[model samples]
Target: IDGFGGLRSKTKVITGVSLPASIESIKARLPVWNFDGSSTGQAPGEDSEVILKPQAVFRDPFRGGSNVLVMADCYTPGGEAIPTNTRAGAAALFAQKPEEESASGPRRPSHRAPRRSST
Candidate 1:
C-alpha cells in the first residue's frame, strides 16, 4: 500500500482514491493478509506477506459484463489455510500437492480370454 497510495493517518479521511480497473489490476494486489497465526510459515523476525493462488474466474452478474469474480485460494509457504479448529481428531482437510506416480512406469492392462455364448 506504500507505492500504490500514500498512507493517511485517519481511516475516515479519504482525500483521494485509486481503484483497480481490470482483473489483472486486482490480481496484482492480491495475496494481501494480516499475518498472525503460525500456519503462515513466517518466522518471528521475517516480514509478513501472504500468498494467494488464482483458482477460477467468472463473470460478475451483478456488475454486468464489464467485471468478473475471481476465485482464489490462500496459501502459505508451509501449506493452505488452516482450519478454525486446531484440535486433534478433527476432520479438517487442507490442500496439498498431488503425489507422484511410481518411477517403474505406467501399469499395463491384463489379458483375458473371451467367453462363448451357449445358444
Candidate 2:
C-alpha cells in the first residue's frame, strides 16, 4: 500500500540475485528507489520523487518459490517520512502493542458498516 493507507502499487523488475537470497541481503544490495508521486496524489509534479526503503518481505504467492513481495516505507528526498506514511506510525504503534491487541486493515470511508442479518 502507498503511504496514505490507499491501495496503490508499482512493480519493480527483479534482476541479478534470485530467490534463496534473504530479504535483508536483497534490500542491502538494492539502492533506495524513487518514483514520481504526482500520479498517486502524494506529491506535486515538480517535486514528486518519493523514496522507498524496503522494510519487510512476503512470499510472492503468484510467482511462488524464493520470489518475494516487498513491503516498503516511503520518505521524502530530505529523509523524512512522507506526511501520509501511516505505515511508519502503524509500525511504531504495533511495536508498543502486542500482536493480538493491534487491529489492522485499510479503513476506506466509502466502505459501509457491516450489515446485521435477520435470523
TM-score of each: 0.30, 0.66
Residues 1-119, model 1: lDDT tens digits? 12123321111212333444645565554343333333333223353443435444445688664455555444445664523212111213212323643233124455688888888
Instruction: Residues 1-119, candidate 2: write the lDDT tens digits.
Output: 55355876667877776755455566666567788888887878899999988876667899887667777788889988888887788877878856545555543245588999988
lDDT for 80 (candidate 2): 83
| Model 2 pairs whose backbones collide | none
lDDT of 1 at 76: 47
Q: Which parts of model 2 are misplaced by more than 4 Å?
A: 1-5, 21-25, 93-119
- Find the number of clashing residue pairs for candidate 1: 0
lDDT scores of the candidates, listed in order: 0.39, 0.75
Worst 10 residues of 1 by lDDT: 6-15
Q: Report the number of clashing residue pairs per model.
A: 0, 0
